[model samples]
Target: MTDPASWPQESASLAEYGEDCVKQWNNVSLRYRMPLRGFFSKRVKDAAEVEDLTQEVFLHLIRRARGGPIEHVEQYVFQVAANTLRDWGRRRRARNQDAHESFDAEMHQPVTDISPERVLLGKEEIKRVNAVLRGLPERTRDVFVLRALEKKKYAEIAVMMGISVRAIEKHMAKALAQLGSVVDKAGEQD
Candidate 1:
């Protein structure tokens, strides 16, 4: 499989375009699954929502591939993922607004899951990581989420975040530093 951090390469021949494109996308999907998983994992603390968003990411890639000659397919995919996330966030915000208007906060029902302890703990860890994400500067978090977690190329991240590729790299470096500090503190707690 191709490294997830690498961009999609051009097709060797036009006639074999479909095959090459599918192969490239599949390779990327397999490799970048971790990064995509991580990004959505943070964006939506819920496992179910993350799973659904990841599926949407791949599906969007497939649709975008249908037209041919995406000079930088990796960048395109990241852009799509970011845009989709924005839409999801808007919908969630709207729903929350509606809920607030409809019912008293204290009267809200709590969601409960009676799953095994391990599953619950894993979910809790995801929530913690997500909370850490919230503490990051917006651009830093996006860069970190896309580059470290989604394994996206710097060019792709820059395009999605609408900044220079170098900015993306620098943001990633800072984000990693922050993450390391947090991890160290958490370890000390343990």
Candidate 2:
């Protein structure tokens, strides 16, 4: 059986070990904290981030120290700092944080105007185009819709319609001429 009187001595030694560890950490912090800040600040932009990274480096050191004594604390601390920075960069990239831009209403304004006047004009234009499409011969309308709306090549359209390439070209020309006339008339009215 263990002696109960020896328990106090063991507890005292454990307390001394704890104190020694604390003192060592305090010395390491005092010696390298500013240097670590400089190391991070040279690579990182934000002051807050530099400080956070510095704290992260110390946290890594503390965790690693628990496992065993570091032979070269300076080298280990720097390596840990570099790894932390790289990890932070990777996470920032994964989140698209680097691509984020601050919102400025004037700078980020919509490219297209969606005002009432512009919307009404756009609706009217669509109506006019639809009216022209409705007036076209069925084959010509089909060719125009296939080429313009469906984005089919002439050869593809010809194959689909079972028409010759020359015939397809003629139909496209006719459709374009009718649409051109409508556009020209609209331009004059405006």
Candidate 3:
């Protein structure tokens, strides 16, 4: 190889291209932020998260624009936003799927046909669950809530909590074992 260091890192006119792209992005950034935020807000209620996602969209566009001059800035921005939304949806679905896979068969029971006795039992069950959850280690409880209640995938939970997926699975298993024992004892009493 002829000198790796001397090889052109980027195009000779890369700075000019980048500068023009930055100008284009600044010109259209404000006009699109509101609409992008609105779109993200519809999917999630958190204002902070919506703002973050809107910023992410712009960042993605900026990266793309730096590669070449965008002939149609508005269209490209919206297209990037749309792609971002699709990616968000895919990740959400995958997380939901991971949560579902971790659940046992009892969790899949249909809830449409509610009986008076069933309602009473459900209330009692909720009380037991809350008590058991309160008794769990802090991380265990958090893992349980995110996986079981929030329906987050183990991988997603890992990323959010800055832990490993195996750790998340361990926490879930511990939580389920504890809860299962409590539920079993309660059933015996009945």
Q: Give the CA lDDT, 0 to 100, for residue 90 in model 1.
A: 94
Clash pairs detected, candidate 1: 35-149, 35-150
Query: Candidate 2's C-alpha lDDT?
Result: 0.81
**Best-performing candidate as measured by TM-score:** 2
What residue pairs clash in candidate 3, if any at all? none
> What value does the lDDT take at residue 92 in candidate 3?
71
Backbone clash pairs for candidate 2 read none
Whole-model lDDT values for every prediction: 0.72, 0.81, 0.76
Could you tell me the lDDT of residue 144 within candidate 2? 94
TM-scores for the candidates:
0.41, 0.52, 0.39
What overall lDDT, based on C-alpha atoms, would model 1 receive against the true structure? 0.72
